[model samples]
Target: MNTDVDQDDCWICYRCHKKLELKQVSVLYLGGRFEVELMQCPQCKMVIINEDLALGKMLEVEKGLEDK
Candidate 1:
């Protein structure tokens, strides 16, 4: 994992307000039509979707919903 802190990419915990580190967290997307990456806060251990991945997943979800 990259240790560099990207202020734009990293998110802080709402409760603790600590910077989320990439190196200390793991992302897992399971049982979805398309694979997705998740960002997790190291301090508070909160999981969030990164912007680009979220958009891609949104597209996939939209397609799935439309097909249904």
Candidate 2:
């Protein structure tokens, strides 16, 4: 849930071409609110959800909520 954006990462925003920074983002899912640090664009406010998060913890939490 927490990660640092290293200078070597060099992740550029597709839309703004600005560098991605590590920021705290609020995620609301299944009536639950969670705060996670992720790579985000400062100009456009776009958040990048990586593959590990999308198919890993996030997916697991989503499935668990749907089954309840």
Candidate 3:
């Protein structure tokens, strides 16, 4: 799977606010629980929260469209 980071969508973590130099995690969200097996951030080594990250990207895209 292609995990290339989209710079515009990727942002510095709120807690650390440092750009995480890592590949995007592919996730499969079920009804009650996530099915992510072993996704991890290369920089901080933390488990990637795929849904929240994707939501953030959507918000960014919406904002960009509104700005136009």
Tens-digit per-residue lDDT, 1-68, candidate 3: 33334545655555555565544444444322333333444556565445654576445555766787
List, residue by residue over 4-66, the lDDT tens digit for candidate 1: 335477577787787765444444434344332345666667866556555565656667767
lDDT tens digits, residues 41-67, model 2? 999989888777777878888999989
* Selected candidate, larger lDDT, 1 vs 2: 2
| Candidate 3 Cα misplacement greater than 4 A, ranges | 1-5, 8-10, 22-24, 31-68
- Give the better candidate number (1 or 3) by lDDT: 1
Better of 2 and 3 by lDDT: 2
For each candidate in the order shown, give its overall lDDT on alpha carbons: 0.55, 0.82, 0.49
- In the predicted model 1, the residue pairs found to clash are none
* Displacement of the residue 24 alpha carbon in candidate 3, Å: 4.1
Model 3 residue 21 CA deviation in Å: 2.8
Segments in model 2 whose C-alpha atoms lie over 4 Å from true places = 3-7
List of clashing residue pairs for candidate 3 = none
Q: Which runs of model 1 end up more than 4 angstroms from their true locations? A: 1-10, 23-37, 61-68
**Weakest lDDT window of 10 consecutive positions for candidate 2:** 1-10
- How far off is residue 31 in model 1, in Å? 5.0
